[model samples]
Target: MNPTPPPTIVIVPGLRDHVADHWQTRLAQRLTAAGRAVHTVPPLTGERLALDAQVANLAATLTPLSGPVLLVAHSAGVITTVHWAARHSADVRGAILATPPDFETPLPDGYPTPAELAHHGWTPVPREPLAFPSIVAASADDPLGAPERVAAMARAWGSHLVDLGAVGHLNPASGHGDWPLAEELIATLESGPALAPIGATPTGEPG
Candidate 1:
């Protein structure tokens, strides 16, 4: 039999949106170079912080893909994916949510305040189980999200939590670039195994 086609990979950036050196952007370029179907959500010049616009943009990006799609979202993009998943579950095969920030709480200097996040419809992040299976990679030392909080989110979303100890937010500022493990997690999701049930213990990084 012919080999099954690979799923289209969607790169979802955080609020910063498409940083030149960000792992997500590099991953997209690398994957596209390797001949994979990939799509990225473009940055919105206006209403950049509005969660509704972000979700809609994600939806629009996915609307044209015809096969199984895997989402790789980081930071705020993770929140956007959950919000989109709450309403539309079709076509998505799986997702990898990395180091999602705790928007409900006060962030450190230079980030949006809790009130601003709420005003932009980013607060009260969706806690219900997602439409498709997913894996959440969380950092023990992520400033934006406490490890305990990230674990709770993973549990609530019924995702298998991959505990990445002390990886500060898994961003460029956090000293991570060309994150090789992202491809591994995406492969696991594409293999189609059921993720850990809601409330399971956080696990070491997935192989």
Candidate 2:
């Protein structure tokens, strides 16, 4: 008998969409070079802030794929995954959610305001535990999401929390390129159980 194949990698970008210097883009390029199946969700050209549209796009991306899928999401993309989980069911094996911004709270000057997020159907994030295994890699000093708040979100989603320390938003503007930690985390998630949500809440601090 043949061994089981690896899951397809699905890179889900944030509100800003794909960036040439983004770590997700780099990971996708590297994975494809290594003969791994990889796909990145295309950014919406219109209705950029509509959460429903984003969810539909993600679903459409996954609809044609066969076998298991591992979602690698960042920033608003993490929120998009949770929203997708709430309404849709697919062959999602796992997810790596990095530096998810807090939509309920008012973001910084340049980001979308809480009112805008609410009006666009991004606020009131889904708090139900996810059906699939997931890792929420949060930054201690991320300007987008406070540590405590993200920790709470991880717990609500029944996800394992990984403290990424002070990596800002883990984006190109945050000085992160080709994030090697993501590779390690992805490996762990790949070999992990189907649903590994920790029963107890963690301290939410880096040990």
Candidate 3:
């Protein structure tokens, strides 16, 4: 008989280009080095429908996996993951929503405007608790979403909150390369009771 396969680590990136030194890329590489299967969604062009389509495609990608799946999403990726979970919660085991942007706030020029955010079906951001275990990590100084806003999201989603403290979006600009704490967080999810439906207690320092 074949040994059980390791869980797939789905890496979902945010908008625009995927930088080489970004923490997400580095984490993917580290997971790969540790013998995990990593699948990263291709960068979307930021079109409303296209982004929604990407969420649907994520469901398709998970359909065939035999083992549980874990999601590691950053920025807009966090939004995408939450939307995907609202529909396809059964397929995911856990998620790490790091530095998600607040759609209600004014975004930088060239990013999705408030009208576009609504048009793209990203508004009324899913606040319902996820069907699986999740942890929402927010930077204390993130310009995208205030710490309180992020914490509120975590509470609404029934997810544990992790306060990263001044790490801008937890991206490369924050100077967080090869985040070693990720492994510990991932391990926490993996070792959780596999059959439990409810999530674990909220975790991390207050954001």
Q: How does each model score on TM-score?
A: 0.93, 0.93, 0.86
Off by over 4 Å in 2: 194-207
Ranking by TM-score: 1, 2, 3
For each predicted model, how many residue pairs clash, with residues at least 3 apart or on different chains? 0, 0, 0
Candidate 2 structure quality by residue, lDDT tens digits, 1-207: 998899999999998766888899999998999989999999999988999999998999999999999999999999999999999998888999988999999888988889999999998999999998898988988999998999899999989988777888888887887788787878888887554455442333221
- lDDT (tens digit, per residue) of candidate 1 on 1-207: 998789999988888755887889888998999999999989888888999999999999999889899999999999999999887766888999999999988999999999999999998999998878888898888999998888888889988888778889887887888788888888899888776664564545422
Backbone clash tally (model 3): 0
Ranking by lDDT: 2, 1, 3
lDDT of each: 0.87, 0.88, 0.77
List all candidate RMSDs to the true structure.
2.0, 2.8, 3.7
Candidate 2, which ten residues in sequence have the lowest lDDT sum? 198-207
Clash pairs (backbone) in predicted model 2: none
Model 2 whole-model lDDT (C-alpha atoms): 0.88
Best by lDDT: 2
The residue-by-residue lDDT of candidate 3 on 1-207, one tens digit each, is 998665689888877577888777888998899889998877755553455776876676677776789988888889888898887755577888888899877887867787888777888798998888887877888878988888888888888777666777677666666666677778878877542222433334321
After TM-score superposition, the amount by which residue 95's alpha carbon in candidate 3 deviates from its true location, in angstroms, is 0.6
